[model samples]
Every structure is written in structure tokens, then in C-alpha cells.
Target: MDICHEAPVKCLAYSPDGKWLATGSEDCTIILWDSEGQLVQEWVAHAGEVWSIAFSPDSRHLASVGFRREHAVWNVMPGQGAPKAMILEGHTGLVVSCAWSPDGTLIAAGSGDKTVLLWDARTFQLLHRLNLFTLEQHAHAVTHITFSSDGIRILSASSDGTVKIWDAFSGALILSLEGHTCGVNKACFSPCGKYIASASSDQTVWLWSIDDGSCVETLFEHRADVRHVAFSPDGMTLSSGACDGTVAIRHIRDIILVQDTDM
Candidate 1:
């Protein structure tokens, strides 16, 4: 229960099956814990601070990125004779965030290079650069990236104070949702894939309708920069964390239900 790293922990992820929890630290290492919070394994994952980590859909593999300009996929729960990790190259700037597609077919990495690189999950080969044009990508460092629940789209939050939606397979820009006055720290899709929630340095979280890219609601409770936001698995509850060390959980089922009814 008191597990820690030599440096500050930067990111964490829970396996889809709820069996494992993984944490990455500024110490350049990763620690794995069991569902009950018992330390299971620990390893050096990056030469520099590990900024982000994401578990595969089946909860076997983990994709991680860091201050280094590369991504690494680890076999967190290896069986007999399994490989430890695979190094991915191609980014020119520090890698900041990573995510696995919902179907386990693709892996996405967001970088300080201001682009999202998509990789083939099976072969570990580069799939798309995703920044063909300046308008199609973030104007600043990409802070976070995630695949939609349906696996058809990708959402990326950036220091440019905007979030962009993209067609997953074609690497085409779908929509750019902008409203935050300050940089966005994180973003995530609703479980139903109907909306996006973004946390910003502006000290608020904004909910956006995916259909029209409209600002559905703005939550202004945090006194400091809002750092993260996540929706409950059933797409009901919403949770946000702030730089002031406050974590807020809200019952959003009713709010979303009202929105649906109004539509």
C-alpha cells in the first residue's frame, strides 16, 4: 500500500480486467501492482522520466512514453519466454503520452514534437505520422491521447489549448474542439463515445458534444489548474483532479440524460 518511486510518479493506468495497476515515475521506472494494491513487479522502463503508460485491451501488454523521443511496449505479465519490451522510434521531440486502441490493434503516442504517431499493435511497426499539415495537428506539445470506445476515432489534448478528433484508420482530421483559455492537461472520451471531457490550466473542465463539437457544459470548481478528467465505465459518473490536489467526482448520468432528451 505504500509503494513509491525515487522520483515523482507521473502517470498510472489500470488494466481493463481490473486485475493490475501500473504506475510510471519521473525516476524512469515503472511499478506494477496487483488488484489489491500489492507490489508485483518493478522495472526500468525509460532512460528519462516516464510520463505516460497505457494497458492493452486484454491487460497483458503496456505502452509507455517519456522524456525520451521513443515509445516502448512492455510485456507486463509475461509468460514463458516472452519478450520484455519493444522500442519504437520516429519522434523528433520528447514523447509525452501513449495509448492503446480499444480493440488492441493499434498503439498511439503523443509527443512534444506536436504529432501523434500510430503504430501497428501486432507487428510493432509505424502506421501513420498523423501530422501531415500544421492545421491537422497540435500547435504545441501533445499532452494526452486516447482512442474512442468504439475504436473508430482518436482524441488528442494539447498544450495548444485545444483537443482534436481524428479518423483512426485514414489519419484524417475530423474536428478541432477549442475553448480552453489555457493549455489542456488531459482529455478523454465518454464510454458511449458521444462526448469528450477536457481538463485545462484555465481551472475548469469542459464537456463537448462529439456530434456537433459544441461546449455542452463547463465545470468551474477547481481553484487551480485542472489536470485530469475521466468518465466512469458506464458513462455516468465523471471525475476530475486538479493541481491543488483536489479530486472531484460528480454524478453525470442525469446531466447526460437531460442532454439526450433535449436533443
Candidate 2:
């Protein structure tokens, strides 16, 4: 589709209601598009390449992190003079990714600084800091972190090749799973919070039993680096993306192919 102004897309996010999409680009801007893929709003979304973007669960706001650690939350509707919101900054290194907690009260962000920072969505105040190294396990940058469906636990992936689970509110790491031969790019909790799926540059995806820190399964069909993964909202299927230029959909339990589409 003919998307927007001259720029290569870097990342994309869909609103919670699935009514709109936001595309971040190398153009240092983000284009807002309606569900039909028509442009609704476009503006300077970042000072540098916008790396990641997410819409608030309420669908009233948008959030982005890019251009070397700069993070911002914006009002979603068309606006003018002053920015719809304020800029957020605290990480010592590049801000890698951020997501809203299931409860919608906290925003959790992972950083190149090797930490996950939690902030109050309304006050923009730091609420908690989850230091990866403090656990005496991870020795590299934290790439991504997501909350469990219960909103009481956080699962994070790091360049140190491990995925760690922590108490969401107290910032206490509960378990560290070390299996990937290479760095872990991402770790995500299933919609039901019963499992955690991890993607690694080691060419495999590991499904872990979140309740006991046991690996339930491993999928290695990609034959290349696996970068990201997510469970379908219903928990019936899983989708994964890789450097192999493929997106595969598989049955969540048996890893059977429901659909495999190359993108």
C-alpha cells in the first residue's frame, strides 16, 4: 500500500481497539493510519529514527522511544500548538522498547542500559527500577520486557542470552532461564500468563512454563535468527518473526503449522 511521506518504515503498532495503526520510520516521524490503511495524522515523532511505538490500552494516547533514549507519550487525536504530552528520559543508554502493563497504570521500558524502568502513566514519575545485573546474572543490554497477563510479573530478555522473570511490583527477579547460545532478543508472556516464549539469535524459540521456570517446548524450524514472538490474543496460536524474512504461525501447544507466511 502507498503509506506515507518519503521514508522507510522501522516499526509499526496497532491501537488497542484495532481501529488505527501507527508506523514509525527512518524519516524521524510517525504516520497515523486508520484501520483501512488511510493516513490520518503525520508528524515529527522523534528526533531520530523512531524505533518502537505503542498505543495506550485506552486508545487515547500513543507512546514512542527512539533517537537515543528519548521517550514520549502523545495525545492520539489531531493537535496543534503544544505537544499533546511530555518527553520522558532517564535511561543511561538507548531506549530499546516500552509497553503498557495489562492494568494500564504502568509503562514498562527496557533499555540498552541493561535495565527495565517502570513509570506512572499519568504523572510520568519513575515508579520502579529493575536492574538486570543486580541479579548477578545478566551482563548485557536488556532488549525487551513484557508484563504477565496477571500484571504481577515481568519477563525480560537480554543480550546476555537469558530471560528472567521478576515480581512486577517489587522489582525482584524470580527466575533466570539460560538456554540460548546467543543473545535473547525478546521474551513475551502468553495472553493467559501461563507461559513465556523467548526469541533468540541462537535460531530457536523456547516456551517456558512461567509458573515453574521450566522450558515446556522449543521450536527450531526457522534456520536463522529468531527476533520476536507473540501469542495470539486467544492463546490458540503463536506468531514469530525472524531475520530469515519470514513470519510463521503455529499451534501454540504442539507447534503445528496453522499458517506460515513469508513477509
lDDT of each: 0.79, 0.73
TM-score of each prediction:
0.69, 0.65
> Can you tell me which runs of candidate 1 are displaced by over 4 Å?
1-14, 18-44, 77-84, 89-92, 112-131, 136-156, 164-178, 220-223, 239-251
Q: Please tell me which predicted candidate would have the highest lDDT against the true structure.
A: 1
Candidate 2 TM-score, C-alpha based: 0.65
lDDT per residue (tens digit) for residues 1-263 in model 2: 23344554545556767566676766788777775667788889788977777778888788888877889998887544433656886899988787887667888777877787889998989889887644435798676766676668777789899999888777887998888889997788766666788888898988877667777788876766776676655566655556544545566644322211210
Per-residue C-alpha lDDT of model 1 across residues 129-204, encoded as one tens digit per residue: 9763343568887777776777788788889999999887887899999999999988988878888999999999
Off by over 4 Å in 2: 1-15, 18-44, 74-86, 89-92, 101-133, 139-141, 168-173, 212-214, 220-224, 244-263
Which pairs in model 2 have colliding backbones? Answer: none
RMSD of 1: 4.8
